[model samples]
Target chain A: MDTTQLLKGVLDLAVLAVVADEDGYGYDVVRRLRAAGIEEVGDASVYGTLRRLYSSGALTSYVVPSDEGPHRKYYGINAQGRAMLGAQRKDWDEFAGTMARLLGTEGGA
Target chain B: MSIVDDAIAQDVRTYAAQVRAALADLGPEHVDDLTDGLEANLADALADDRRAHRGTLADEFGAPADYAAELRAAAGLAPGSGGQRTGGAVDRALRQLVGSVRDIEGTTLARLRATRWFPGVEDLLVALRPAWWVLRGWALAHLLLQMVGAEQGAFWLPSSSGGWVLLLLAVVASAQWGRGEWRTGPRWGRVLRFASGVLALAAAILLLTLPQAHRDDVARAQGWGDRPVEDGVVVAGERAFNLFVYDADGRPVEGAQVFDQAGRPVTTEPYGGDRWRQQEYWPDGAGDPLFHVGVPGPNGETRWNVFPLHSVPGWAWADSGAPLDVTDEDVRGEVLAPSWPFAAAAAVVPWRTGPEATLPAPAGASTPGATPSAEAVPPSDAPPATDGSAVPEPEPAVP
Candidate 1:
């Protein structure tokens, strides 16, 4: 199954989690997501997700002038983003638990 | 060396532009936001450990529109096809127009460069840009003049009050561009800049195709174009023929007004009423339905044979009972009569004589005993007197 569909639902969560720990620019977020083993994440998708989240007030951003290239737009999760992330995490954990029981993973050797 | 570098620079620029176009209609701010650092990022990627990447850069990005769609979806924005941005139909259409113009200019320029073996054409075209700028201003002024109701179809620069106004305005516009910048305030400044570009393009087209081929009243008056015989074919440079006018009675009608088939005076010469021109005789009295009188060349003694202009009903009309009606109040004929006399009469409907006919015996031979009978009228419009007699005495014009 193409996890791209699955990843679409969790992208908000994934992007917020990556930036929650430290502010990162668009491509930097992509690099991190790939580093975390989400190989299916497209570079453009990550950039757009960052923009959407920032415009929604879930992420705050500032431009850092660059000597090497274009000034980078760095994004960090704000209080609103953190609050939403906490809520989403709760719902995901509950859903995972129920799925795990149905799939026989609860006590399977 | 620089040409190759320019080609590369142009390639990169074209790619970036394609990307920008894909994002058009999505909203300018949104498009810019997505593409802000894309070029710089691309430069970096290309620089990283060269030789690591294979194939063309386009292969990596795929089609720009598809890429844009992906970005739009990821950003939670609606697709352009969904009509979210269709409210800017004008804006979208303008973008497309500009795009096409740019594409045409680019391809044409590229083709020109590629064919540089044509010897100076490529470099010459590039060097002509400055000249095009000047022409642009001139063309722009002409367009503005016409828009404000200056005469249309006068391809030459304006000589009227409006033309002077255009010159003055151009000087003012140039004056405003000091130190390589426009001095006008922002609003008017932008208007001038845009007009300058549009006018320049328009001027480019005008200069390329309009001016040289365009004929003006001045040129026509100067006998620069199709002229009528009534205009007396103003012998401007090297005159070919001299026209002498006469009445239906073959009496030398000096100063008889010449007219075109439409009855327009070929010249403003005092002979005719109002003239199509002031002084110069229109060449060959350019008009349909003309007439010509032919006298056999030096080969034989022949009187003038008049033929109606073939343009009338056709050449056959000249052979009709009255190939032309010369005796009317006004007969407009433009013709190249054969044996075109350097000095001859302009009588209507010159008479035709068979090729075997010889000139009438010289009229000076007439004696009282001959009684110049009923056959005295010459069969042709040419007065029988080859010696330039004032008139032909009889119907046959000869005994």
Candidate 2:
């Protein structure tokens, strides 16, 4: 199955989780999500998710000046983001267990 | 930094600009909010790609347009159309029309930008946008001036100081509008943008046709040189076809040349009002030779200044252009004579035929020759000739 199609349903939750674990800039978050096995997640989608979270007050951003090339904008998850992530996590776990049981792989994995 | 790094930065900036352009229909502030850190994000992504030994960003993600769409969707913004579909039929139709126009415009711009030189040209155009704004304002001012029927002065410039003030205000307003300083709601902003487009088109058309209008005015002004005062003599507010001269005896004088106060020959040649009659006079002739043909002068030039210029009736001339001898005996066609006002004007000085009957040195510059044979001389008691055949006593001796 294409993970990209699956990633769209939980991109917001994934971005929030990644940011809560460790506050990071745009590319850093994208790299972290890829390393966590969501390799098909696009850069633009992650960046857009971060912006949306910031706009909705679930995340806060600050500018970090860099000596490399340009200034980097860093985003950190807030309490609202963490609470939303907790709720989505519970729902995902329940949904995954129901699917696993239906497929008769409940005890195999 | 190395030149390679500079090239990468430039590529990233170009890509970011393309993304922003895809979302341009959104308000400038909204677009800014969406694409604020776009360049830095793209640069970071490119650096990561280089370290990981991946292909270009385009290969990894997608085209800029698709990226912008994904961004817009993920950010909880509307699609590129941006119009909500919760309206009535008319609103839907209007939105459809606007969307179609936007689609065509975007497609055409994209095609143009794909050309080799178009990006540089677009850069130049973007740099010249302020100048265009000022010109748009000037055009709007001229349009208003024309609408109010107070159009004056030069074509590209306003006429008066007040006009200049209006132009200045319009330009400032236009520049402010271009810079997004005068903010409006979405609907009103769209309406104003459409109105400005129409006004700009009208101004371009006006500017293109200005030279033709100016030419017409110049032609009309120059036409004043040849006027009625010089064309045909008007007497008592009526067009006088022929001028008759009389001697001291109150007898009709033949072949008397007339001139104005300035020694210009006074002729009735130009008053051929009926083109059909002129065609009858000289059917296939090119020039107005018949117009100036009357009695011969000393210099042998066809002078029209001869008084009471004799003319054979139009039908008297054959197809060969020669006047046929049409006397009272052989009147084949109708001999329509000119409308003569009087048979003989009362002479100012009475005739003293015995000795000192000195003639006023012939009126015009052309020297008078021997008297012409009187084919249709007006009698003393003759009434004003209305139509055909004024000569009651036609000389059979005339050939």
Q: Report interface Cα RMSD per prediction.
A: 15.1, 13.6
TM-score evaluated only on chain B, model 1: 0.34
Each candidate's DockQ: 0.14, 0.16
lDDT for position B231 in model 2: 70
Error of 2 at B311 (Å): 19
What are the per-candidate TM-scores when only chain A is compared? 0.92, 0.92
Runs of candidate 2 with Cα error greater than 4 angstroms are A1-109, B1-86, B107-111, B152-154, B160-162, B225-229, B232-371, B381-399
Docking class of 1: incorrect
The 10-residue segment with the lowest total lDDT in model 2 chain A: A56-65
**B1-399: candidate 2 lDDT, tens digit per residue:** 789888877777878888888887664545655776788877777767434645565664578899998888888777644433245778657665764564465446545644788757765776687988987888888887777767653366777787788889988988998866885654576677887898789778877888888887677777786444547778789766577676776656655667675556787765332324442233243232232124434343345576665554443345665433333334323322333444555658755675423433444343232233243232122234433343533211111
Candidate achieving the largest DockQ: 2
- The alpha-carbon deviation from the true structure for residue B204 of candidate 2, after best TM-score superposition, in angstroms, is 2.5
Clashing pairs in 2: none
Q: List per-model TM-scores for chain B.
A: 0.34, 0.46
Stretches > 4 Å off in candidate 1: A105-109, B1-13, B44-54, B81-399
